[model samples]
Target: MFNIDKNKVKHANLFAAGLALGTVGLKVLTSKDAKKVYANVVAAGIRAKDSIMQTAEKVQASSGSILADAQEINEKRRQDEALFEEEESDEK
Candidate 1:
């Protein structure tokens, strides 16, 4: 815990005033420069998004192939199990 005197409140006000002044000065001096930097950032973001979409499509294709192969393997296993059960029943 911390304790402070009410009379010391002037320092807080002074700090706020300095922060506001600095913010206004930065906006006035760098507005144009900030715009150019932001434009480049947006363009790069767009390119990254396109690449992500392409990668997702390739992943989807590969997943589909893997799923199909698994289903085929499962069907063959089921058929083999059925044949094994039939032979056991005949011997009994």
Candidate 2:
């Protein structure tokens, strides 16, 4: 007696149908309008990234200036303390 599995044949047919559908889907996805939309979306993303980078640069510059001012203030305080010590010692 010869025997064949019907279930395996059914699975193979379904797999082939899925592959065909997948090829058609790829063609639809790569159409002209789809490519333009993709390009615009990417350009917008780049612009957003550039804007964020500019803001970050500005913040970094401001922080650096603030740190410089703080250091200057600290130096002035040290100088004032030294002057006070000298004045006390002169009086004594």
Candidate 3:
């Protein structure tokens, strides 16, 4: 009679269990209910992306307006400073 190794038998059992689990997992993941869940997740992601894009557009528009106003204010300040300098030079 040949002697069997306990460690080899234990490893073989574990390997068989892992293979069975993998096959079942693959089937469950490819089932109809899983497909529906995936579709819903993708649809939700699309809606979220649309909402974020709209908010970003609004923020971009607001920033552009703010930048224009700031530039106008700086231009006015520069003109006023030039006028004051001209008046002081005339008085001298």
Candidate 4:
């Protein structure tokens, strides 16, 4: 007493068969092309990453230089202020 609908079962089987055949055919047809496309994509990604890394390094170096220059200016200002205060005290 299997309460299965015969038509529905037939339709399901046909769908499964078609899907399997299509997948196999596509893989056979495009495996080589897929590999080549994948390689190209990987190469492009590597190049993009390398370029970004170089730009980041350049930005870091420039920021360091800017910070060093600011520190030098601050130190010079401090020294000048100290000398001026000393001169005023001597006058008094």
lDDT of each: 0.94, 0.97, 1.00, 0.97
Q: Write the per-residue lDDT of candidate 2 for residues 1-92, one digit (tens) a residue.
A: 85879999899999999999999899888999889999999999999999999999999999999999999999999999999999999999
Q: Looking at model 4, how many pairs of residues clash?
A: 0
Clashing pairs in 1: none
Candidate 3 is scored at a TM of 0.89
Q: Write the per-residue lDDT of candidate 3 for residues 5-49, one digit (tens) a residue.
A: 999999999999999999999999999999999999999999999
Prediction RMSDs, each to the true structure: 6.3, 2.4, 1.3, 3.9
The digit string of per-residue lDDT tens for model 4 on 1-91 reads 8899999999999999999999999897689988898899999999999999999999999999999999999999999999999999999
lDDT of 4 at 81: 100
TM-score per candidate, in order? 0.71, 0.76, 0.89, 0.68
Better of 3 and 4 by TM-score: 3
Residues 1-92, candidate 1, lDDT per residue (tens digit)?
Answer: 77977667888988899999999988976899888988999999999999999999999999999999999999999999999999999999
| Model 3 backbone overlap count | 0
Clashes of 1: 0
Q: What C-alpha lDDT, on a 0 to 100 scale, does residue 37 get in candidate 2? A: 91
Could you tell me how far off, in angstroms, the CA of residue 42 lies in candidate 3 after the best superposition?
A: 0.2
Clashing residue pairs, backbone N/CA/C < 3 A, model 4: none
Q: List the residue pairs that clash in candidate 2.
A: none
Candidate with the greatest lDDT versus the true structure: 3
| Pairwise lDDT winner, candidates 1 and 2 | 2
